[model samples]
Target: MENRDVARLLRETARLLELRGENPFRVRAYEQAAEAIEQLDEPVAERVRQGTLTEVPGIGRGLAAQIQELVERGTSEMLERLRQELPPGLPELLTLKGLGPQRVRQLWQTLGIASLDDLEDALRDGRLNQLKGFGPRLHEQLLHALSLRRRYRALRLLAQVLPEAEALRERLRQQPGVIRVELAGAVRRLMEVVDRVELVVAGSAEAVQQVLPQLRQQSGLHGGMLLEGALPDGFPVRVALTTPDAFGTVLWWHTGSEAHCRTFVRTYGAPEPCPEEATIYEQAGLPFIPAELREDRGELEAAAHHALPALIELEDLRGVLHNHSTYSDGRNSLREMAEAACNRGFRYFGTGDHSQSLTIARGLSIAEVRRQQEEIQTLNEQFAARGFRILSGTECDILPDGSLDYPDDVLASFDYVVASVHTRLNMDEKTATERILRALRNPHVTILGHPTGRLLLRREGYPLDWPRIIDACATYRVALELNANPYRLDIDWRRVRDATAAGVPIVINPDAHAIDELDHVRWGVAAARKGWLTPEACLNARDLDELLAWLHQRRQSVQP
Candidate 1:
């Protein structure tokens, strides 16, 4: 399989290990492995099959052997055994605040806790606070966790609206005097996810002008468009078309990162004499600013000084990273995932699944890890028969106490690693950052998956000092994962810009568990560009060889 898939498998394996009360260090190892794989350009499983697995580094004999077996089998027996040992829903418990592998295991062992509902009852009744390590403070946090979970469940995948946007585009095209119409804002850049859409119209005010009014006239349209007017600071949205003369200037100015845009205008004062955008920019003496950077950040200023580097584009990406399959709570198989990536014109695909400790997620164990690896290899062989590339990977869970899911030796088995937290979300800023920092030091950790564990509308992640996290990532040269999942756009857009400024490469990952989910990367990339990220700040934009070499550095034990 390819590096992307290898990274996914490592991550899932780690999460499963966490749910099972596996050694914290072990979980960290698996997570580190995932980080390494996510940054790898080549498929680790293929290397194993070619007797070159250890040649890439960190991979010791034990992990390499496990990977070899996974390349031959289709499942891992150890993971299955863990599932049987723990209550079927134990992994889901880990998602709550004040919860982790150890605590959850303790609750299950001592209080017979099996789900979030049971834990909530215990906390309300004061039973949970009586536990030796946990106190009232933690109990309160659990309540917040439940509340956050409810709020963060609904970040819709932006790609899901492409068809609707297209339909609207068609409707706009039929208008008179409409010379051109295209999506602007985040959607135009093919980002990993998005919220709303913006359309740029090229025509006189009269041409597309009718479109907005027509929308208002449509049955039920005016009511839907009405503002709630219920909040103290609620904003209203109005649709109208302006002349092309003012189109670019107005649209770009309004689209925002006011900081970025203010920098642009301040550095190059408003264009005088020319009412048209192109002429204004030409007079301003800067190459036309890309709409993506209209955020009014210092990008406009930097561009004037010829200091800003070329930005990355969607076409620069060679493969798909951070995906999952049926191996652990995913919805597709290795082969299916590979085909989808290939169809998207990607050079490789990463298939990550859950680790063994995540019982609720059906994580993998030692034996199952081998089987899954084998299955990945079998899929790769099948793909190869038709000239395709796939990678075996995993998304490993980061354990509490600053550790990963699997042993170092076992973790080094796959291609890369994507380290993330699946529990203990209530830890205060200090401990949470420390926990993640320790995992970053692992030679196998190549990337930190979703620095923030947030889920949009459902829950916020543990408090973190983002400025420190960005600095740490830069020091370690660990790629910061921009989880493109709509529900969990962690390493938020604003921070993404800061990360680029700090010299940490960003990987926009969909964290897709199904084949159709790969498209989520567009939203994240849109968010990234809005922050003025340059091409060099993104690992996924590099060529395969360059990507592999960079990833090897992360492993710290590899030379090839």
Candidate 2:
């Protein structure tokens, strides 16, 4: 089994133990082991083979034995026993945002709410409302979570599914008689969440048919042309079979917004057999439109007038901002993260570790903040000789009343501050908007981080007057963050164009918690491109000197 698979089992075991009211230490042991395995650079299976699994930190002999069992048998007796002991769907309750093991236990024991369906039943019958701790706000939040769960149940985050999809596409390409393979649909459009992984395959019908049964949970081909199946992980996948001559037409048809395809047919007529995708656009008497902009969001009109945006690419970014380090909940230390950014050709790295209000992340206290800034100063001294610099920053919480976490003096000490809302997320639209507007008015808030706290496919962003928020950002000179964390790519791409058009610079922040996650900026860049962002409009696209000047200017503006 892969490390992630083993880690998942271990984590589920931890959660199950927590739900069962087992010893807290035992539960933490499992949780720590899972974290250790997940962060290992090498495979746990290999360590198990070497009989050195226990040598790894956090993996005791007892846990190693369980890991061995999981690796060899693809299942653990302990996990199976735990599963059998609980209601089969009890664990699924944890998938809801606010429902931790404690709350799930409360629901299960207090109201017999063991599953989403049971929770829904309780909500319908008003049993949930009668529960002691189920307040009106919690009730509304639960309803929203359930609604999001139902609406986005079929979709998967692009980052979560893209690697699997690409690997599957490559495997199909190696099949005998297959001529070519191109990914299409939402995957091609670079949508943050996708419902299906679609591909256009150039090959013989017989050759394509030969590979159908190999895939899991397949529906037989429709009209001997389209094959539908689930990837090994059960993400929905579809393949359109065509000859090399008609590859472009099939790809264009499958890689659609439905509206884009209909608009094209209405304006230019049905596409003819063309092997090149660009040729399809050329034949339509327009410039080649990028797949990311083919949402019928005026891309065709833009192309007609040669007005397509030279969308920002990943290479345009010269630094990373709003990142975490070991000073907070980040897995990597400050030096490690900064060095990793430097290795990736970034000239500057901004450490936006959690501020004091966020205890869950071990947010920095005043003393800790001073110590971290001293370390940053020391590191800057060493890095200066190497032409790299680390910026002292904080992901300062926007308090319930919309005030910044640190007082003005401490806030001014940082090179920049990413003001974000991390608590009291159930606010109504006007309240949320005003809360954010107040943060924007704070001169210390250099960038508005993840303008919405939405976790894609898991929870919807709380309601907000977005136009007002954008205008407030423009007026206050607060750059809006396109948070690069795949799950929370907030300041959603749909709103990015409006924000940028109103002269608000979009800062694509990885919100990186580890060295490896620094690459997450690519996903944010993809979403940014879809939003028509240009390098000139991207905050991190500025060079180190320009970034320093911008930060210094902001500080100056706030001065007496």
Candidate 3:
């Protein structure tokens, strides 16, 4: 097995043990072993065969034995035994935000709620609230979680499915007659979540028949189906076999949204054989639409009018913002982060560590903030001759009462601020909207971070009237952050168009906690393209001088 596969098995084992109330240290050992194995350059199986698995940190004698068994036998008796003891669906409950092992165990032991169905039934019958820790707010949050889980039950994040899909495509390409392969469906559109992966392959029926048996032997493919099937791990996949002549037409049909395809058929009749997707669009008398804009959201008409915006590209960004350092919860030191940004060709870097209210993130105290600023000043001196800039910033939390974590004077001391809501996310629409509006009204607040507070597929963002919030952002001249963390690509792309149309600047920030995460800017750029954002609409797309000027202008305009 691959190192990733072994790591997954170990992590799953750890999670199951946690749910079963196993010894804390033992469970932690498995978790750490999984992480260590994942980071190893070589396969864990090779390490096991070398009799050096125990040399790896966190892999004790007992854990090494488990790894050996899993590698040699393809299964762990201990893991299987634990699975047999627990409810089959209990592991799925852990995927829900805020429902950790402790709460899941509480529900399982007290209410016999094992599956999502059982939990839903208990919630409807009012039995969920009878437990010790189930308060009214918790109950509401659980209901919201259940609703979101149901809506996205079969969907996996785009990042989670892309690697597997690419591997499958490569496997298919190796077949005797397969000439070309292209991924389609939600994956091609780069949706935040995908339900199934689709592929269009160009080949002959005879070649396809010859390759079907070989494909079945590959991992993740279900037997008994030649043209369509699901991964044994539950990822659905559909493969469309076509001739080279019809490949483009088939790909176009599969790539466009259902609504777009229907509209195309209505307007242009059935699609004709074309050499490429652009050919089909030209035949339909429309300009070529990008895959990201294929949603039936007026792209066809916009293309006909030749008015599509030149979407923002990754290279357009000049600096990184809302980044974390060791002064807060980030893993890297301030110099490390700044140097990494410079290495990535960024002209500047902004430090946005957590403020005092978010104790969980080890938020910086007032004194800590001053110390961090001093360190940033020192780092700036080191890079001064290099023409790279570092800006002092903070991710100051927006309290429940619509106040920032830092006072106005303290906030103004920074070059910029990213005000965000880190807690009390269960507020009503009115309260949530007002809370954000108040934060935006603060002249010291430069960018609003992850405006929705939603973790993709985990928790619903707090309720808010987005139009009102967008209007307030424009009125207050507060830039909205397109937080680039894949999990929290907040200020959702759908709302980005509204913000852009209203002339509110959008800032694409990795919200990077580690240097590697600086690459998340690519995902943010993809999301920005989907939102029809252009370089002109993004604040970070400006050069170092222009960015500094804009910051100075905003600060001067808002000065007391």
Compared with the true structure, model 1 gives a TM-score of 0.65
User: lDDT for each of the candidates?
Assistant: 0.67, 0.88, 0.85
RMSD of each: 12.8, 4.0, 5.9
Q: Tally clashing residue pairs in candidate 1.
A: 109
Model 3 C-alpha lDDT versus the unseen true structure: 0.85
User: Candidate 2 residues 1-560, lDDT tens each?
Assistant: 98778988999999999999999999999988987876665778999999999888988889999999999998899999999999999998899877899989999998888999999888777888767778887888788778878888788899987888788788878889899998999999999999988888898656655665544323323222777777666777788887788788888888878999889889888888888788999988888888888899988888888999999999999999999987887777899999999999999999999999898777999999999999999999989987899998999999988998999999989999999999999888989998988888898889999888998887778899988998888877789999999999998999989998899998999999888899999899989988999999999999999999987886787665
Residues 70-118 of candidate 1 have per-residue lDDT tens digits of 5566335655566677777778787775577788888988898887778
Candidate 1: where is the Cα deviation over 4 Å? 1-166, 177-237, 257-276, 385-387, 556-560
Q: What is the lDDT, from 0 to 100, of the residue 317 in candidate 2? A: 98
Evaluated with TM-score, which candidate comes out highest?
2
Q: How good is model 3 by TM-score?
A: 0.82
TM-score for each candidate, following the candidate numbering: 0.65, 0.88, 0.82
Candidate number that wins on TM-score, 1 or 2: 2
